[model samples]
Target: MEALLIAIKARILELAPEFLQFPLGHLLSITPVISVFAGIFALTTWIERKGLGRIQNRLGPNRVGPVGILQPVADGLKMIFKEDVVPRSADKIVHFLAPILLVIPTMLAFSVIPYGNRLVPIDLDAGILFFFAIGGSAELIVFMAGWSSRNKYAMLGAMRAIAQMISYEVPLILSSIVVIMMAGSLSLVDIVAVQTGGFWNWHVATPWGFVGFLLFLTAALAESNRSPFDIPEAESEIIAGHMTEYSGFKYALFFLAEYLGLFAMTGLAITLFLGGFHAPFPFLNWVPAPLWFFGKFAILVALFIWIRGTLPRLRMDQLMGLAWKFMIPMSLITFAAGATWHYAGKGLLAWILCTPMLLGSYVYLGTALTKGQKVSKRVYRFAD
Candidate 1:
């Protein structure tokens, strides 16, 4: 405990050396990061709503400010002023506790996410594992919320939540292993540093790299409850699931946790495979590092949004099957493929040797996609 305290003190001191002189100068020094992130988080929420609203051919929150510019601010006030309710049958303590519990870890998970070279607050050596460990909190607190809600729907939602997360978490971890193996360290900084030169150095360039990328992408979607994987809280079936009885600010807290989770997961994807905070292409590395990192981050987030707009939620059995039968097995195959290529000694020969397998996988996936079109056509014809 003493050692841990000392380490924490060191981190705090590192965050602001001016504290020694001005007594609270570090707060000012770190103010930009906190305020900027807070603003970004709030703004992103509004952006998502507006965009989603646009997709549905409606104006979203346009009354809050011009074009709903102050919409988040209004929403914030609404949540803050509203009376939080505990369901009559709920476990009051757990119900009250769960939303806060869910939100904190979602925010804290960003600590080790390397924003840029030297931009991180504390880039732990075990960043990848830290990310994995922290993410588990979501599953736990969500269960707490669901179980505490004292509704059968909430209970079912919580069950689905637990099952869904556990299903995807395996592939998430396995996919990350491919990265840890490639970078030879669990640190996000080290991962980025290894890919310093250009696009070719990035993991997505390899056979296992492609496999790992797709695995991480799918698992991340599952982890975040985005679209196809959003079975736990599917409105049509479960009626908000774990958060069924939460009201006002408590509901907002759940909403914030989700968006923050999306942000962190996208950042994680950037760090692990896309060369966190790196420029998109080799030639663009000449641009400032922060721009490069954030540029890539933005692209991934946009991809996530695009997907949410495009896909329908998966059925529970479909969700479970995809994880167990597909994601897990594919991730393992990817990790092995990555390791085997590295063992063959990291060069043109390694790339060449992996080419056939890569081609085969691509062909198989392509054929599968085509088969879906054929099946869909038959289904439509039969319906007609």
Candidate 2:
């Protein structure tokens, strides 16, 4: 299957005139990735709305298309036709440019991830570094959106978003660094290559890897401005924060950039810890590699939606406290644990040694952090 796709791509490039082939080759590689993720973005909106409605005991958007499956189309049309409103007092150029800037970096970050067997787009030696570098630009764009708007609420929201990102970004990068330490390459493709043999060889199978995966997932949620970590745009408080002033397609672009970033980060997680496109069992290798990658991607996306519905937004103080007091410390511990696992020969001795220290640190952190907080049993009052 992989060879067939490669052959088809090579054949197309061969047919193109020499001067156009360079650009044409890139177009072929890039177009499919954009198309696939754009489709996923639309589908995820429907799934999230329906899933959240089900969680809340309601039917969501049933009138748009068969059970509201075409709602994303309807929403897109509305955004496109809606009036693009700019505040009279705002810096119009930056306000207009911020969303476009946000989309660019998010899209560029997608180039390095390996989606299937031999399917990396750019394959840079420092691919993972490139991804993070592109991702960090969103922070500045967020502040740009807020500052340009000249609205107090928007500025406040942007500030919160920046702080939230800086706080969580530490543990987020640290968590992935553990994988780099083990995999010994900044190239994401190489990271995926190291875990290819079987499920047991997958990084998440080890003690530090398991801890690292959890830490990465939590930090990714925050980095993407997902809920409980969504305090920056908490509508109840700051009214969309950095995005409060955006309207029409500009507003939609921010959302599109956000979902794309989510997809990119989630894809990275799958590559780093879930063994990329590798099948769980040797027998299942017959399944297409792309299928394995997307299957895992879907599960993680659903998990994100489920969490959004289930968890309430944290208070600002609590959010910062969690990052400083817990996440960073835990991530550092996981890094140490990964080192221990490496030195202990990745044998039974490594598992026996690292597991205890990691688990023990987790228990101690939880205990010590919660020691001063008073807890009382919930008393529910029935309303008639």
Candidate 3:
């Protein structure tokens, strides 16, 4: 599937005039990314609302379209027509620029992700590094939105974003570094190539890879502000956090940027740990590679939605505590284990050495962190 797309793209580039070819080549590469992910973004919004409604035992958005499949279209139109409300005290320029800046970085992060064989938009040598560097700008954009709003809730959200980014970004990078080390390249394509044989060769099949994958997903949840880690947008507490003062189209941009970030993070996770676009088994290799990529992507998105429905939001203190007290230490241990696995020649000896250290650290950390907290037995009271 991806090969055909790649061939068509090459044909277009070959047919273009010299000066236009360079720009057209890039346009061909990036246009599909933008279109596909933007489509996914729309589909995710509908799926989330419907999925959440099901979890909460109700039908959601059925009035909009058939099973509300066209609900995202309705949302886009609503945002377009809604009043553009802005605070009188807000910094006009920064307020206008914040959402735009946020979306740019989020979109750029996808450029390095390997969608399928030879399907990366921008395959830099330091592809993973490029992804992270572009993604990091989102923190600054969040702060800009909050500060420019001149709203206390927004400012608080921005502050929380800073703290949250600091705490989680460390562990996120550390977890990914294990993959980079194991694969022996910063190029995401190279990393994917290393795990090409079968599911067993995938990073997540190994001890350190499994631990690293878990840590990566946990930090990704925090990074993308999903569910329990969604302190910045705790609607019950602060009413949309940094987006408190935004309205209409600008507000919609922030919403779109967020889901884009989530998709980008999920793509990176697939690239690093789930074997990218590779089929799970040699016999399955005949299947279109893009199908495998998007299939895994869909499963991860559903997992995120399930988690959002199941977990309660963490308190600010608890969120910070988890990042620093548990995630960071575990990520460090996982990194060391990856190194051990490499030096031990990636055999039973490596598994024998690395697995115990990881399991022990996990148990000790869980026990240690909860030590000072008071635990009371659940007392169920029936409603009259």
Residue 300 in candidate 1, Cα distance off native in Å: 1.3
Stretches of model 1 off by over 4 angstroms after superposition: 1-34, 57-61, 281-286, 359-384
Instruction: Give the least accurate 10-residue stretch of model 3, judged by summed lDDT.
Output: 375-384
Tens-place lDDT per residue, model 2, 287-363, is 99989999999999999999999999989988898899999999999999999999999999999999999999999
RMSD of each: 5.3, 1.7, 1.7
Q: List per-prediction Cα lDDT, in the order shown.
A: 0.80, 0.93, 0.94
| Residue-level lDDT tens digits of model 3 in 239-327 | 99999999999999999999999999999999999999999998999999989999999999999999999999999999988999999
| lDDT (C-alpha) at residue 147 in model 3 | 100
Ranking by TM-score: 3, 2, 1
Query: What lDDT would candidate 1 get against the real structure?
Result: 0.80
- TM-scores for all candidates: the values are 0.86, 0.97, 0.97
Which pairs clash inside model 1?
277-293
